[model samples]
Target: MSISSAAPPKPTQVLPYATKDLHEVYTLGTKLGQGQFATTYLCTHNTTGETYACKSIPKNKLLFKEDYDCVWREIRIMQHLSELPKIVKFHDAYEDSFFVHLVMELCEGGELFDRIVQKGYYSEQEAVKLVKNIVEAVQDCHSLGVMHRDLKPENLVFDTVEDDADLKIVDFGLSVFYKPGEIFSDVVGSPYYVAPEVLNKHYGPEADLWSVGVISYIILSGVPPFWADTEKGIFAQISHGILDFQSEPWPVISDSAKDLIRKMLDRNPGKRFTAHQVLSHPWIVDDNIAPNKPLGV
Candidate 1:
């Protein structure tokens, strides 16, 4: 008897949500940005000549079922939250044999920190406004049963270069849908912004507030509260959850702002301030408290 080789397994579809081919609708242009699994490009509509940002995720990059699921979840989450003014609007999704493309609103103003640096002036009032927008977006996400697992200054982008341009939350790659009281075990999120509960491998939506607190701290002091040379050292510092208020800018920072940060950065998730509470806090609600003095480092 002759031995016969078995047939190769069929490849699974990477995007069940995409029905059309991306090339047929939009012409891909210059590259905008690149991430681990996707490369964002400037794309123009073939028919209307309108411009948009396209995030093209290669199928080959998705080596596992979980990777495909993550991309799917990201698409769905963006679609679900597109109506919110603070979120980057999702236009459509498309797929071919090799790649999945997500078309979204083009934000030309760039990252939050870059815009701040370009302006040449930073103040508590400006930081308060930025935090208010962030917290409000987080509140909306939580209310919609979505948890933005990753929240940081780099993910915040402006729609235009205008001084009054709208700041939008651009990346939702790590976002997930959650039910009340749901707990997640994944240790996900950027260093210096990850919550203590997250490092413990047990956390919820409140972890987002911790990230906002870290961003707010950086905005105020021009430095992260927890800083180290390596990722491991940063994680260790974050796990300790010790905030430096005695540093250069902290003494000059407002008391109410510090209070809010303390509450948001609480090691225990239960004690952390809720999105609503952060929005309702005196510093956020009272404009007089946040001074116009430049907080440049």
Candidate 2:
């Protein structure tokens, strides 16, 4: 359906919309996923028969009151990048008296982490392809001045379960748009993947690259580069930027791959490679090169 038929969508929250209007335009289906403040459902347009992922956020949640603007920002960011490759599509945001609805592209495959675990073992070539798609998605967002503060395995999904399906980056709840040279102050993102600057509450886009580096380490090694028995321990390890390559997988992985991860996980934000640089790095762009003999994955 031409979203033109319904009331024009707003980038931010509007007054409670009519429940009837929602039912009139789209047929809601099964529950697809859940979050801290909302649940996503499968839905189809009444006229267009187009399928979409609808995130439903309850108005009564305390989180809604605190991060109301963040929700709107997430919607707007998705809207801005809807047409960009490797980024999840955003169709619309609808609100009623009780809840807000976010319609977006449906990612059918499971999380990248889950897929890797299921596959049991993955090659360096496979990791390279996955990282390329992920970097391109982040690069697109960075080009638009948007920072996906939270980029983890849970947020990366494939279009389908097919072997060659394209990967997509999703979830922009912690994202924020900023001007060049401006420093972001909010401390956000999962502890393990967060950049050192974020821990100090002073950071920028490079902070996100650090997260990609964390993810790169996990995908390639079949395990996280940093870990501890407790949350405090994990954060401490992250702060120190200590990673061990003595494990079985580490010894077998190619030197170039390890080099790229090190560059991305650099303690100094100034030295960390940006998304563009990561995409062009020798490890990521070189196809003929083979990975380590025993891909711990």
Candidate 3:
């Protein structure tokens, strides 16, 4: 998890892709997930009879070869972590004529977003549990210098069951590594979750915290904190820092929880709390300390 200042900012070579390692004749089952750049399939290991989520990133859609390079970074980041129970496991990467195939842990649990909408809103206790686990996972990512630019609930998957379940952080397409003093300038991420600085083309890991705030709001209420009539309206609201709590729809959430959200959504990155700090907040630590409860506050 130590940051290496001397290492190159980004790796060049496409992390070696081996097709033979992935047994052939493996049938591609139903779709698992899809994004702008990749399509995921549920596939079984031909020999071991094990299941995996295989993500195919088409080279053509990789606007620049750098996108392919990012895939390598994602591989390296995933490989270095060994096995973080909360983070999705990356098994292997290979290439076909049309795309690069990434074999990853198959999580059958549907998106957290669907669950949120289905239930209208999560109970305070349930929210605490999910948030705590997510914060712990983010802390792990920060320790490794990997920042997940997009961290919406859709990217968080539950393996099955609600209590003591493994919530895997999936999708690293927009992930990046930053060494000390390294400043990243990329205006990327979903509109609702993106930080204000991101819209202005200036951001760092704190931006991810902003996304976490948006998610917390969604978990407490059934909708995002910032909604707009149009994309421009949404961007303006985010840019102007116009996040207001809806008094009526707001659940019986703790005051500490609301304060934590405010701290995370702070417009100034300097004022925002780091993942580690957020994890230690009273709302997360004192009020809710179940063995593996979600950090609700």
Q: Rank the candidates by lDDT, best first.
A: 1, 2, 3
The alpha-carbon root-mean-square deviation between model 1 and the true structure, to one decimal in Å, is 3.5
For residues 1-297, could you state the per-residue lDDT of candidate 1 as single tens digits? 998996444446756654877888999999999887789999999999999999998888877777778888999999999999999999998888898889999999999999878887688998888899889888989989998888998899999999888889988999999999999999888887898889898999999999999998888888898889999999888888478999788888899999998998888899899999999999999989988898755
Best by lDDT: 1
Full candidate order by TM-score, most accurate first: 1, 2, 3
Residue 204 miss distance in model 3 (angstroms) = 1.3
Q: Can you give the lDDT of residue 177 in candidate 3?
A: 85
Best candidate (score: TM-score): 1
Better of 2 and 3 by TM-score: 2
Model 3: what TM-score?
Answer: 0.87
- Which segments of candidate 1 are over 4 A away from where they belong? 1-11
Error of 1 at 216 (Å): 0.4
lDDT of 3 by residue, 99-190 (tens): 67788888776678766655553466677767878888888888888889999988999876554567779988788888755678878888
TM-score of 2: 0.90
Clashing pairs in 1: none
Least well predicted 10-residue stretch by lDDT in candidate 2: 7-16
Against the hidden reference, what TM-scores do the models get? Answer: 0.94, 0.90, 0.87
Per-residue lDDT of candidate 2, residues 204-286 (tens digit): 99998999999998887767888888878888888884688778778778888889999999988999999988988898888
| Residue 265, model 1, lDDT | 83
